[model samples]
Target: MRETPSTPAPRPIVGMVGAGQLARMGWQAAISLDIGLVCLGSAGDAAARAGAPLMEGSGRDGAALARLAAGSQVLTFEHELVDLAALGRLEAQGVVARPSAAVLSLAADKLRQRRTLDTLTGVEVPAFTPVTSIGELEEFAAAHGWPLVLKARSGGYDGRGVWICDDGRAAGQAFAEAAAAGLELYAEQAIDLAGEAAVLVARSPSGEVAVYPAVSTYQRDGMCRWVTLPASLPDGLDKKIGRLARTLAEETQLEGLMAVELFLTREGGLLVNELALRTHNTGHIHTEAAVTSQFEQHLRAVLDLPLGLTSPVVPAAAMVNIVGPADGSDPATRLAAALAVPGAHVHLYGKGARPGRKLGHVTVCAQTSEEALALAQEAADRLEGNG
Candidate 1:
């Protein structure tokens, strides 16, 4: 882990799991509060290296989590991919888990999440069929048509654990491999969605709610590459999307950050895409552009503090993810160049560089979305050695 620069003063302690860039940014916020932010991280997570006091271990390791949580006033997560079983054990021992056990379970399992909305909440979902075998998928494909999407029920993000299948045979083979590994698989009719959008909301344990302006998300093959503040849709659709998000948060009684992803079908109707119960990739731009960064909002919500404003400080802001090239070069090396640009900021996650892996992100705030986008692209280009 990177050594922490000297702190001006000590602060209250907040324990966070998964020392990714999200947690790293949270450390920046904690600095102002003079609060000590301790991270439970892998050996060299980028955030962990950038100076949060790291409990070097896996979140899945019960002993390690216990050690990390021992002296914290409150606990929250930067990433949702924690060992829930271990967290549940700590909860049983009377430790508070913001977003709570029930909510976390839903966010972690796509199948459970779909069932929660489709069957329990009466939300309209695209016709979906579960696949436990190649035979089942073949049957589903025959019924639903070709080019269907097969999604793993758990542990998938940024285009991973998802496949677009064009034939029964392909579906069968994928289904067989997925099923053999005990991973639940499901198929959905590929809708002609206009695009994607997300609403990032924070809820305190005291039930205070603050919703950010709904944002438009751009994805390349399921990996979100750019997010625009304030989606370009009309007011009516924005209201509908916001209402859908609030409904889910109220229903789940979620405390802390919740990002509700949605799809605008070609017919102009909005459909629920997915839900993330922690800080989200889509909300990264909020860190510098919004009055209250999502990282602080997560802390405030979990600690039951008053929620902060979600208004953007600038007129427009865009966030572009930095994915690594085939050849590995230190992403941090590009930060100097990115910083040289006006209104440009870069966040690098300390992880081994890999093709398609998000190494970090750049957020640029400008007078217009296009301007912000151009700056973001410039930063991305430099980060990827394109320039």
Candidate 2:
């Protein structure tokens, strides 16, 4: 057996690729443990404003990643968009990449995810067909019916890189555009469902698991607007969902956080839609509502430590995303107004404000789901200049 290097003289530092808000807030978590949270950020990135040791470069740069990897105990990522080839290079050079390249690769490509989900015996996924050309798309649509969703086999997220085709003509047009842009496309039947739900699960290196309450997401233009935890589903559905979530984490051999996005059909059944192998937008409410936040759980799992308790701190909680406008005033005033509400916790991701950009989130806790949702909505409204 190969001997590992001795622990650093004092606290261990963890290097994170992509210094977005995730890395910024992770810095807060690292502070409590006195661990250095190093970030590989582009020059002048918003997270650089947080004062962490920022390695200015692209995550795809092997030299940059190596520089960040040196002296770090573990390496992880804030965003999945990081170049997997670079991570594989790092792994070849003996750097530790939590969740492993094998697992992350499955989450990186939508086509691979769909195939893997299909291979799993008990997992239920939406009916999907891969389309590489206009003819295939037309045939799939004709067979499956119209008004289908066209999704890029890779890189689709938060409403970006997704399109809906109402007819064969629209599908052919989308195919032309996608082909011209060198994009891979897939077709899926657009089910008439109640809404979307997400369940967050974390697994330690030793296989211990913790599952958070399942939440329903409200989306507009494919961007999540709000998340309500402990979703009002039929009795025993929560437990079943929790079991399925754990099964995914274990099957993936995941070491850290994973969010399973699902479609909750009107018939009271859940179909897994996608998986995010990182801390997720829908799980942000766990920061204030759960006894152990998902961020901390991620840290613990990635470090190969024991799992934390995942019980809810309140009966119900809701999280609303703060999206900025094309023309808006400084966010400080709006943040202050939202903070004025009791039981409302605001987390601002320090980033340049762009139309439809996720600036931050407000999480609220209350005795019931409705009250918590109202509080979260008020906070979002205040942040969006509705005050």
Candidate 3:
């Protein structure tokens, strides 16, 4: 009798630093790839609730991070809230962390990113300066004009640490508040008119890279509400955007995913808004549109696996976030209705209801961008009890 050959074990048990919806989506991709995913978050986190392996703890806890890494082949990240310094310590102790501390610094520190991009040609950053006092704020406003933006140097997300000031008195007050929060602040010349967009790119340790099509993102209150494929950019802008994304991926020696947000001005110029060094919200539309989702691409990049195709398989697709309803009801209650929409793929995070919080998202694929976006919006509205 011939004995059956032994099955090879799955390589690269990934330890992700957060258990939010991003981790949950990554865990789903890991399942398809036959990989292990251990996320660091409480039992109540979306990934944890979905049965993803996890270490019960906070991302900021160094001890917890070590515990999570002890059993995994490589450590990665789902969000920027993790302690960067702790990651540096882990690297010193010989734990493998992809998009290393140095790479993380390039994206995690807002001011550093601005300064770094400022040196690169073909990339426009809004005029900015680190503001230390009210005097600095005034000086910047005088140079750049009123209605400038004040942003925290680091450690802020989802529009939490940004202020738009229209006058010296308001700018001074905003400066004082930032000082009281102990935040290092920077003042930026606000770009007026037009919309926003994001270009998602991924690079592997082996130097392989993938660039996805740029998408138009709609934002409200500085929080992204939806993203649509086939963005309405000017002639020749698509090629330019793709080239820029490729340059950043190759030049930075990026070993993970990066979503380069851009400010598309009415003047027809593109400005680099920010970079997210891991799987970003803007890529959620890829779940239904792209041949390979950003979650899987990021995993492949960090693990040095051959990267997957990043091409969009559908003609058009859009992702609409289901912000919590004012009535504070769970999307689960409206799931059946959302799923009834043709071509709508709904993903609900098992999270508690909270006003303005993103509880889930819906992605739709159709023959045109308008149809995809409209269907996605309808599904999301149904889920949020607005339809």
Best by lDDT: 3
| Model 2 spans with C-alpha error above 4 angstroms | 1-9
For model 2, residues 285-357, the per-residue Cα lDDT tens digits are 8888898887777788888878788899889999999888767554556787888878889888877787788
lDDT of 1 at 205: 85
Q: Indicate which candidate wins on TM-score.
A: 3
Per-structure clash totals for the candidates: 3, 0, 0
lDDT of 3 at 27: 97
Q: State the lDDT of candidate 1 residue by residue for 222-241, as single tens digits.
A: 99999987687865988777
- TM-score for each candidate, following the candidate numbering: 0.92, 0.94, 0.96
Q: Candidate 2: TM-score?
A: 0.94
The lDDT for every candidate, in the order shown, is 0.82, 0.84, 0.89
Clashes by residue pair, model 3: none
Task: Give the deviation of candidate 2 from the true structure as CA RMSD.
Answer: 4.6
Per-residue accuracy of model 3 over 6-68 as CA lDDT, tens digit each = 998766799998999999999999999988899999899999999999899877888898898
Of 1 and 3, the candidate ahead on lDDT is: 3
List the pairs of residues colliding in candidate 1: 2-49, 11-34, 46-350
What is the Cα-based lDDT of residue 32 in candidate 2?
74
Of the pair 1 and 2, which is ahead by TM-score? 2
Better of 2 and 3 by lDDT: 3
